[model samples]
Structures are given as C-alpha cells and as structure tokens.
Target chain A: MKGIAKKIQASEVETLRLRLTEAEEALQAIAKGSVDALVVGGPRGPVVSTLAGAQEPYRLVVERMHEGALTLGEDRRILYSNRHFAHLLGYPVAHLVGKPVANFVAPEDAARLADLLDHGAKQPASRELKFRRRDGSATPALVGVGSLTLDQTPALLLIITDLTAQKHSEELAAAERFARSILEQATEAVVVCNADGRITKASFAAERLLDKPLEGKLLADAVPMEVELPAEAHHSGVRMSSREVLELVLERHSLRGAEAQICLPRLHEKHFLLSAGPLSDEPGGCIGCIFTLTEITDRKRAETQQTMLVAELNHRVKNILAIVQSVAWQTLSANHSPSEFKRAFDGRLRALSLAHDILTQGRWGHVDFEQLVERSLAPYHGGDHGMRAQWSGSRLSLPPNMVVPLSMVLHELSTNAAKYGAFSVEHGRVNIAWRSDGVNVLFTWTETNGPPVKGEIKAGFGSKLISRVVSYDLLGTADLDFDREGFRCALTFPVPKLRTDALRPLSAAPSPVH
Target chain B: MKKNAEDLSGYNLRLYIAGQTPKSIAALSNLRGLCEKYLSGRYRLDVVDVMADPALAQRDEIIAIPTLVRCVPEPIKRIIGDLGNSDRVLTRLGIDVSAKV
Candidate 1:
C-alpha cells in the first residue's frame, strides 16, 4: 500500500512536468511568430482572428498581362521581371532577375538597344529588337521603354511584345501579294479561284479575254470553261460541262495540260491550255486552287485553217489536172504535125493558165472581168505598152466556167489579129466591148485600120475551138464575120450571180476572217 | 505500424494565412501534403485568410502569417513558416511519435 501511494505521487509529478514542457514550447512558438491562434475569451465566444490588409491588386494585373514586363536598374541589370518576360527569353523568372538585360538581347541588336536606353532614357521610346532565347534561337519583339523611380532609384520599365506570329502572318500576306502581282503581269491568262470556285483574282490577259469584271463572281459565270478529261478520269473523254469542269479543277485538283474552252456571255469562245493546282498551308492539305489559263485560240484557228486549205488545195489540183488532160487530148488530136500541136497546145495552155491566175487572185472562187481582160491580152499587145487592142466593159464578175472558155476565145481572136488582121500592120486597131442585158452578157470584138480580109478563110482549129468552147463550156452562141473592114465576132452568155458563190470556198466552221 | 496508421484519426488543425502571398500559400500547400501523406482522411484542416477575416488578426498572438495550429488530440501545438521542413514540423509537434513508428 505504501509503494502504491509513492507511485501515484510520482505519476502526478510527471504529468505536471509534461504540462510545463508544453507551456515552454508554446511560449517559444509564440515568440517565433509560429503560433496559429490564441484562444481569447471575447464578449461572446472564442473566435478565430486574422492578419492585416493583403498585397496590392495592381501586382496581379502586372503578372497577368499579355505582354512581357521587365524592370532594369541603372546598371542595366534586371531588377524585376514577370513570368511572361522570363518566358519570352526561355528563362525562369528567378533566373532572370539581377542579370544584365543585354545578355538576352541579340549580339547585333544589343548595342542599339543600349544606346536607346542610355541616350533616350528620359523620353518614352519603342524599338524593334531580337531577344535571344536560352536555346540560342532569336525571337522578334517590340520593346517599349519608359523611366520610373522604383524604391528611390531610377529604373527602366520595358514592355516587350512578341512578334513571331505577327511577323509570320505579315510575311505570308506579302508573299501572296507578290504572287498575285506576278500573275497579273504575266502575258498568259491566269485565274485564281477559291476552294468554292469563286473568282478571287484574274490576270490582265484573262480580263481582256473574258472582257468582264470577274472579281467576286463565280468562275463558271465569268468564264464558262469546258474541259475534256481523259476517259479514265471521266466518261467518254468528251467535253465536261462548266460546273463539272470547275469541280474537277477545285475538288479533284487536276486538269493539268488539258484543252479547255472558255465561253463568256455574248462573247466569242476562247480556247486555253489549262493547268490547275491547289493552294495549301501544307502539303496534302488543300485550302484553295489556282488555275492557269493559257490562251490557244489563235493556234486553234490556224490548225483549222490549215486542214481546210489542204483539202481545198487537193480538190483544186484534181480539177486542174482533169482540165489539162482534156486540153492535151484536144490539141494532140486536132494538130496534124508536132510543130502545130506544140504551138496550139502551148497557146491553149497559156490561155488556161492566165485564166487560172485571175481565179486564184479571187481566192479560187471567180474572176473579175476587167482583170481577166487585162492579164490575158497584155502579151498580144507587145507587153502592154504597144497595145492597139482596147476593151471596154461594165464592172462584171464572171463565173468559173466563163473564165476559161472566154479567155480562150479572146486569145484566138487576138492571135488572128496579130497574124493576119489588125495587129499584122503598124497602123491597126481592135475594139472589144461587152454589155450585160439582165441575164446574158453580149461581147463584141471589132478590128479595123490595118488590113482587109482578101479571100475566103477556112475555119482553123483556133476558130473552131473558140466556137465550140463558146457554145459548149460557156453555154453561149458565137457569130463570126470576115468583112473587108476587119474581122468581127459577137458572143453572148448569162451573167453570174456572185452573192453566195463567193462564200462557198471558205469551208471550215464559221471561223472569223482572222 | 498498421495500428499507428489506423490510430491517425481526428487530428484537427487550423491554418492562418495573409491572403495569397507566396509563403502563406506554400504553408497551406505543404501542410496539406504532410496531412495527406501522414494523416490523410484522419485530419480536419481549417484555413483562415487574415485579409478576409481582419477581426481575427486583432489577436496579436496569432498575427504571424502562415501559422498552423493543431487544435485536436489535446495539448494544442503551433507551427510557423511554410511547413516546408517536414522533419522540423513533425518533431516540433511531437507528431514523429506517430510517423517514425
């Protein structure tokens, strides 16, 4: 019992000592400002207490700004910097403070920045400079400078705006403008369209060829282009419609080197060599399309005209060959000797060739009567200066058949006058006149002033040939008379209707004269 | 040790902070981590922003910011600073009696 009583006293002393130690610890904590709360009996109850006012709200604004902020001391050392400023230079905020601002500036721009900050510190200034990152890459920034007194010391405040995204967009816009100017100046017609086939841009050549204000209009409305895609790409390899063609250029992003036809409203159609490609921010990512229309109208017209000319030339050559064969047969059969055949055949072929010259001069269509007379009789008149043979007629266009036969008849008459009639003597004359009587052309040849017909002259091959051609080929009648005054011949034939006949030989489509 | 972890319950703590200052916020953060690692769901923590409750700051004994008070489990304790030094915090409160076991 006595031991148990002693143990109880010992336990009570230990509890008191522990309470004393807790008190001492609490006092130490209070002195160190480590105590969380002091429970005081108030008028109502024990309540929690708090400290004084909080930090300035303006500091939050500075920390949350979009642009970077930096405070530099007189020694150019960074006295303070926000999170944004440190991030702009790829450094931690704690690592950036008290470091020289010039260390982060590019080597080339560092001197210029120092000069501005030193010489122009009084005035607010803004300048562009490159801020180098910790990883050695440089970023463009617009640095705005101002002076402020920070804690009784003069300091410089810098507001830095990163220009990476801004500069990238500006450069892309400038490059697009450059590309547009080049396309506008190019001689080839080019049209740039958006993904939806809107006419965003048109070249000068395209504007002139389309002859319309093309901007903001649908490309299909401005230039109704039709392209012929290959059979594998489309059906039938035929012409695609305007909308389908635009879809082919935009959606398919194809039609490279294809033949395309552009037909604007109320304007003649134009052909172009088409090339299309996509405009994209990256490869395989299409934003829009660019079409290059190289005009091929003149080349197409030339090709068509060449084909038609070949066909026409082939037909004309065969006709000429048939005519020559017949003339050779007649001349060979009629003449009794080689010398006579050579002379007659040569004269007939020369007459036919002279008539062909007039027909060719009229584009292988018809002959002008006056031109035919002048060219055919010039040789008989001693190279046109010593001409005693004179012909007068109204302005008439002869048909193709009349040309060869009449030229032969005129040649025979002139030869006869030169050999045995008016032209055989020095002082001689021949007067040829033709008059059209609504349907028939009455042509009369009168010769005088040289020699008289002395005897009965039998019909030679030249005379018989002239009569037969006037009756057969010309479909006319000839009356010949040999009198003492001179030899006379009167022939009549139908006048030609030259309205539609003049247009038949041009055998391509209704292509323009050009 | 399993019984010690299970015995870590009803440790009520009160924290006093002066708004969002760095030390004030860090103390709360560190205290939370310490509770989560050692006490977890067994502790109740009450935060008092002195800026919001100015009348509470009139208690001069509690004016030091980022002060933490262990109000439960008898013999109330007080701690200071960011509670960043876990060993000091645990030792000062004799909470190592539970942790070091």
Candidate 2:
C-alpha cells in the first residue's frame, strides 16, 4: 500500500512517465528472452498465449547445443544463460541471471576468459579456461567470446566446449607416434604385407637386408630364401617357395618361428630365425601380415664349432688313454720293486694332469710356458722335504700340442732332483727359466746345492720319454748333464701359431671365436 | 472485471510452467521477486510444472506456460509476458503501484 500510495499521489504527468518506463522495461524483458505468458481472447474464452514458444526454431537449436552458450551484458552480468550453460555448472538457470560469468571460473583460469573478452575474440578463436561446477569440481573448457547487441544493449556471447575427449585422443596420438619411431629405427628386418602377400611397408633394416627398397614388391620375390627347416623335423625337406612358407606360418594361430637361409649376391648364405604374425584390422579379421627376420649367422657358426669341439674332445680322450698305457708299461719294466713302479706311474700321471689343466685353461689354444713350469713342480714345493723352484724368463706363448710333453719333462727332472740331485737335501733349490729366441724358445732347468754327480746320465724311462717327446711331439732337442753342483736340462722348441684344433687332424674350423 | 478494492491485500496466485527451462524459471523467479515487493506477508503462491502434472494444467485452464493467475479478490485475472517487468506485471494485475523504479 505504501508503494501504491506513492504512485497514486503522483501528478498526472508523472503517472504518464511511469507508464512509458514500464512499457520500455517490458520490451527489454522480452528481448532478453524473459517473455511471460499472457491471456488473450479465444473462440471459447480467454486463453494463455505462450509468447516464448513462438521462437520455436531458434530456441530449439540453442536449447539442444552440445556446447554451453550464454550472453553477458556490458557489465559482465549474465543476462541470458541457456539450459546447457546452467547444466554445465550444475546450477538452476534462474540463479545464473545477473551473475558475473567470472564467478563460475576457477580463480587461476579467470584471466584466460578475460583475455578473450578484452581482445574481442570471435568465432573459431578461443581461450582455454577451467570452469568450476556447482559441486566445486573443475572442467577444462574452450571459451569463444563474440560481441552482440541484446535489447539495444552491448553484450558478449560465449560458447564453451569441454576438452576431456580431446585430451584423451591427444594422448592416444602420442603413443602411436612413439610406436612409429620404434618401427622406423628397428634393427631386425621387419616387413608388412597386404592380405594377398604384397609388400606395403618395410623397415629400413629390411631394405638394407634385401639391398633394395621393398615397396610394391611381392614379399617372396623380395626375399628369395631357401627354406632350411631341419631335415627330419617340420615337413619333408622339399624345396618350398618363400610365399608358401610364410603362409604356412601366418595361416595358423600358432607355429611361427622357422629357420631360413638367404643366399644373396656377393655374400655367404645368411641364416635367420623367420617369424610371422597376422596384421588384424578387427577381432579375428586378417587385414595383412607382418614378418620379422632375425639374423642368426653367429649362432649357427657357434653350433658348428661346438660339434667340432665335441669330436676333438673324443680324440684327445683316446690319445690320453694311449699315453697312460705306454707310461704304465715302461714304468713297470724299469722299476725293480712294485712300490717303486707305483710311485713312478703316479708321478707321470700327475705330470700329464698338470699340463692338461693349463691347456684346458687356455681353451686348448695357446699355453704359457711359465705357467706350465710352475704348475709341473707345484707338488714338490713348501713341504718338509720340498724343492724350491724359481722361474725367470720372458713369458712365451707355447703351442697347445707341446704343453703336455714339455711339462712331463720338467716333472721327470724335478723327481730326479728330489731323489738324488738337489731336493734330496732340505736346502736344495732349482730354477726353471726360459727366454723367447726369434721363432724358438730356449728353456732351462738348473739345480744347485745338492750332493750330486753320478758320472753318467741316467738312461731311465724318464730320460727316454723326455727325449722322445722333445723330438717327436715338440720337434725340438733336449740335452741333460750330471754336474757336480746339480743336474741341468736345456731344451729348445719352435712355437707355432696355434689353435685348439691344430693339436690333431679335424674338419675345417669355424671362424667365430669361442 | 470487479475490483473489490477493499479485499485486495491477500493475493492468491498460481504460476504454470512447462519445465525448468530458462524462460519458465525466469518467470518464476521474477514473479517471486514481485510478490515479495508488493504483497509481502499477504500472498499464497503455487508453482506448477505442467510436465510433472498435466492434470493440474487442465484444472487451471492453462493453454500455455508460464501462466500467472490471480485467483483471489474474485473475478480472476490472468497476466503474462515478462514478469521480470514487475511494473507491467502489477499494472496487468490491476494493482496501482510505482512502476518507474
């Protein structure tokens, strides 16, 4: 009533002015999409007029837009916010009116929206901001701001788009790029083919392996390899086209790896572990094929070497047995007593074992001379009745064949000194030394500080064996002297460029070391 | 239309809306603002969503939304269009109040 009294007391001119203001306000409200339903004359009676429903097409479009759309007055107050905009913030549409748009923006991203507003940005030009929902959770959004006039008042219109799905696909695209980089730089020969076995893509390694670009060529025609599956294994070892072999691999869900030998131009036959898999476009739908060829040349060579090594091991075992028999036969005849014969046979056996140990350490290749001498006399050192042996020489690389024979000779000399020459006394010592002489090594075993000298050098089985091996096995000569000081033996032997297989006759050796 | 100016204090009003659409919700919020300003402590208001109860729409003789009906003070009156314009709304409702401000 107070408000009514204030209006009723107004002069006639003021009343007219108030009416015009109301009419303008009403026009502005309609322009701002706030139309009210009115009652009008109908055929039956008064009926309600849905003034808003008249804008059916445009309202329908704005109502159903995927992106949130809203209009802001010049003062940054939201004059018209669509249902989509209100729903994005999880708020009632009525509450959004006259609210500043920045109220819904996260504090940090509030400036991002300001940039668009200040720069007068238009469609397709946008700034990214985080929009805070009614629940306080943030949504990353792209905001495009444009100028428009609503009810003759300057306004800004915004279209906000969500960025969740775009971010997810960007991550997916990065992963695909990572996979592509690996394929481009792959080392194994990788080939891609269509369903009809036509080549589509090949890695740089595949191009290098074939010595030509692999596009537009049939995979079988590009790689003309002989199918080298084991003769007794897989199928019959009949000649097969590379196409048929690859299909046999891809057609099955399992059974992929095979052995193939490619004989290329100006190169030895290359061995590879051939593997194939299906390129699938969908579940259980084969779009094409992919093949990887891993070169196994070194492995194949080592396999051949291992077979040869086993054969060599067999020959050496037989030779050792024969030498053992001969030593037992000779030792039994030379010793007067059974105890002496047993002792001599054991010593000779121990000598062979020490030398064999050194050869085995060298993988049956080059044996060191200093290591062999020290090892042969190792048993006679540091005991109550021990013979001190010192070696002083430039180290020599002894061929594998001469190691056993030379070590045996040193064993015999040391045993003789322990019995009569130098090691018979507690303070007696011996020196075994050598020096490299051009192609030959000059080696010596000298004993001192012993009650010595039989005028004659003993012609026992030890001397006889030593001379025989130095001449026959080593292709060298040995000289022994029974001096008053002690006993001395000097030997000279040629050191050949040696290998493990050179000790005996065998098939051609492979070149892959070890 | 009978004014019955002596018994116009307590206003009984019903607003018909289709849904929570922007236009319908704005009509509702604006109408609430108007009633609180002019008929404070003296009005009975009912907000009906026709989508929720179509039978109520038929009972109220509502053809379109949002419809504001003044049922009290006899000779019922209907006024619609932007209730955001409180002066225009009051003028249509036969209440002589200040509309300029």
For each candidate, the alpha-carbon lDDT, in order, equals 0.73, 0.72
Docking class of 2: incorrect
Q: Write the per-residue lDDT of candidate 2 for residues A142-202, one digit (tens) a residue.
A: 8888888765867788888887678768888998787567768999988888877788888
Q: Compare the candidates by lDDT and give the number of the best one.
A: 1
The candidate that achieves the highest DockQ relative to the unseen native structure: 2
- Candidate 1's residue-wise lDDT over A218-272, tens digit each? 8777778777765445454778765676666556556667788766555446677
Score candidate 2 by DockQ: 0.18
TM-scores for all candidates? 0.63, 0.51
Model 2 RMSD, rounded to 1 decimal: 11.9
